[model samples]
Target: MANRIRASFRKSARSPRAGDGKHRKDVLDSLQELRNSIEKLDDTVQRFTFYNLQMAALRVGIDLSLFSSLVESEKPLAVGRMLRYLASFGAIKETEKDTFTSTNISSTFALLGFQAAICHYANTALQRAFNTTQPAFFWLQTQPEKLALFQEYLTTNCAGMSTFLDAYPVREHPTALHPERVFFVDAIAFRNRYRDLAGRVVVQDLAPTLQHAIQHAGVEMMEQDFFQLQGIKGAKFCYFRNIFHDWPDNKARIILQNTIEAMAEDSIILVDDMVLLNAGVHWQAAQLDILTMTMLAARERTQEQWDQLLQSAELKATSIQTYTASLEDSVIEAAPV
Candidate 1:
């Protein structure tokens, strides 16, 4: 009886081996799936890491102001030679070697007139992130570096207008009289502002030829707010660029009233700014309009807005011309009614 019981136990143990092969296959399948999942995760992480690194590199390059200097030079140069040039400009610290430390590179880029590309890219990125029509203006205001960069960028970019003006000849019309003197009005003088920040003045002593040209054309530089400007009794042409959008409808109206009080019927008001087009027209300009709305509670005007503003200001728009530079800005010619 004992021998028979032992034989039964041995047979039962051997029968379970038949199912062992199927169990092992199931385990192997799960292991393979896990391995494949892990490989996919690794790939995703690597791609994200690479994108972040590229953005960081761009930011570092821009904050160092290396790009602007390169653009200003209008030539290509080695990185080491560029570092030396930056040091000479007092934009960077002198190093024993020609190589610039990361710190120096970032500090130089933070300065005014050297951070356009950075701001442009950042703003565009921010707009994408929020999925909003405009770039967040509050972010720009809070970030002093971005604000400084934008102002500097505008200044540098706007200077190129000299070429555009030279290219287009101002027509002399008997009915459309040119001002005996054209005056530029702003609260802060460009020279004083530049000196205060940069420890140097630019265009303070206007170029001899430029001065002679202005004199010949009967133009003047007036450093005062248009609203507060005095001693103007004739039909002088008043020019404003990127100015009117800084205020709301009521405040802008007041400014226009001040101008009307100071000028004659024949006075021309030239507004150089962007006029927002329809939805499909220009996305960038439309985005800027929304951005202005958030920042200063202002906006880029539409044709209707422009017409309304001019009418409220007691001015009539006679002609409007658009220029396509890197960005589009318009020139509106108006006369006091």
Candidate 2:
């Protein structure tokens, strides 16, 4: 059996097909299952967080048809299903007359994702599970909430346009002499930061989405294919925000090569994407691990994987920073080898 499995693995490994291969698909599928299991296990121990408990209880309210009962009878659910209602409306509430009602807040809890999360833990007791107890290194490192500081920047400063909505606010302001020229390839045109955001912010994209956001005269916006040689040569930074993950490796390589051609020896190819850590992967990264596959025919990469890809393109990672817990803004600062 072991020999047969190894032989099968070898055969699958040798296939020239790109993207999802038989063995690779199996591995990723199993990985998704494992992460889901881990998430389920983690939920059990997070009850002390109060928010989790509240959400869990609300899901029970849904499963018991408590919301629907409250709406129909206009009475508080003493006990059953939140059906025949949109979860976004609200969860059921108890009134002064011992009747039930719902608020917008409860509606949030009733959302399918939230409801599913809550339902998963219904009738379940907290357990002393090891998976839950494991240190959330990824969460601790990124502290995603910090990115909220720039939340207002999106509307007031950025004019509410970007590739990924929740784009990070780059603190590296532009200097006087060699103002940084940031090439945002297929990213949100943050028009606000163009003047001094690390330097002159240039946007390279073909999407009509950026037209409105390209308000500033100083910020350069280009409607060119990234597969071709990018315009800005010897730029201080060529940034691809969540762009590579949406493309297969070969296509990603082409994009990288194009960017590489325009980069200086010292120019940095900053990849603002997820860096899949080998161990202790948080649930967000785990979900994204599969999201890339289903949503796009692409895959997120680990440090080793990234290194291999960069090396193949004659580039190297100089520094890496995890700016967000969900890895929404993790930066892989790379340079030509």
Candidate 3:
């Protein structure tokens, strides 16, 4: 079966390109079918052997400095048998009998392999391998390029999705009238979305993140640690977007408690996050859940779990306004009980 699949791939590689995207999709579908077959095998250990083999190859390649040496070499060095093995998988380009050149894929692997190695050696706790003791944000402070990439992701992440404003009645809320009391966390996207709305939006984060936000005008950027007490007291709205999921319930409770202390009787906390279903979760949400778990030992919550978390923090969810149905992304509106 594997031989047949390999033959199919060889045939497709030689085939003439079609005008439309159909040909490309057909190739992708065939590849996916092969992957699906591997995953569907009943022997779980054997199924995982494919991934183990790939990882072993990666480890061996790195240990021998195969990718870097090839990428930096002025002339192709004498290739090893391992080079031919990797070349078969398109990791490098085979030139002649025992020579190879680095491809774009191999070059990228060479560059990123350093970053991966750094992370791997720095920390290892369950699946959270980024750093020990410090949270993700703090750990990122040491990595400027990674921190920028993370901030960029947060800023443009809401491009096509239905924003919290579309689902939550922000305009009708009493807080809309008093913008001074609206405290927005991770203000990059939020400030742009609510620009026309009344209020001096105070964006809070660690000192490093606030530095980025400070360059932008209109919104007030404040250095804040959410784990500590929220600086501004009795705000009309204390909004957090995609923040809670980075923490487990214990750590999340501390953040909520701090926010609660700064809230007025009529104040609301808008938690913009995915409210996953109990069953048949969307693939995107499930992927994010796994990511959070790996990154911070956290998990995305179901509606019931959200309710329980809020209740533990002495807050009640007033409404769950789902703007994006496909990903179950919603603005969980809650207030002090």
Candidate 4:
């Protein structure tokens, strides 16, 4: 699959008209402009925005029930007949004079993935975030750290790691929508839930996010303050993603200590974050490192730093797995001494 994907990428890049990275730059340039405007990013910051408007449209279509309504309706869905506000977005256009229908794009976004009863769940979560994340949004209105600015977009505090647990959209019990999102705790557990062997997943998170998850299944809500953790003892595996990037070495050491304490003798703890490549590395990791600094007052780690961190808590790194060959995110797995 990886080879096929790489082949497809090579095929696309070998286009006769466009030279290497030309088409990519053109596509990213438009995106950078849009994000600059929407995020209110500084006019000086040259960053790409890429298809964000389409994502906004997709989010809207999911929220308004427009796609579902059009699917159920036998007739075309004209802009005028639909939400008065949506006429401007051009989500659906007039097929005949004033007559509109659900475009193929809209249909794919809604119907492609979800339970019939829970179709609107994501919409509801976004609505909740819209209300709760307003402060962070207002603060982020064109901050230098545009991406990490979203760190507080949902949670009020600068406490980065806790925000994911508190602000994650997929609450309401433990249904593994995406294994990547779940952060591989136990391969068996992930496999079981992925295959639907586990009836329903249960997750523990902060109050607000947990409340949302509780809608489907009442769950134990626990705020992330690793120093105070006593539960989860003797677990075979513990996983933390994008967590260490939020704190400095000292605080991160404390978090690792707690994780080590929670693990069983043979348990593994996976830290998923960007590890800096000192040599000929892609610009992506460097960009994220800057964002981390600007937003959280933290920085991404190097492989040496990661090893040092694990050793700080008397843990040993078993392996490091980088996604693709890009300087993107990676997983460092460690086991307690």
Best candidate (score: lDDT): 3
Error of 2 at 209 (Å): 3.4
Off by over 4 Å in 2: 1-199, 212-214
Per-candidate clashes, comma-separated? 3, 19, 1, 9
What is the full ranking by TM-score, best candidate first? Answer: 3, 2, 4, 1
Give the poorly placed runs of model 4, Cα more than 4 Å off: 1-202, 212-222
Q: Per-residue lDDT for 1-337 in model 3, tens only?
A: 7998789778776778743488878888888777776752222332343343334445566768888888898788675445554664566777775677888767866876453763354323432455357767667887788888878865565445567878887667654456555545445566677777666677788877766664568667778899999998876678888899989999999999998888877778899899977644544454456557646778788898999999999999999998876468899989988
TM-scores, one per candidate? 0.43, 0.46, 0.61, 0.45
Q: How far in Å is the alpha carbon of 11 misplaced in model 1?
A: 67
Residues 227-311, candidate 2: write the lDDT tens digits. Answer: 7888777776677866777677887899899988887655667787788655444444544454455335577777877898888
10 Cα displacement, candidate 2 (Å): 47
Output the number of the TM-score-best candidate: 3
Give candidate 1's error at residue 38 in angstroms: 39
lDDT of 1 at 299: 68
Error of 3 at 185 (Å): 5.5
Q: Is candidate 2 or candidate 4 better by lDDT?
A: 2
TM-score of 3: 0.61
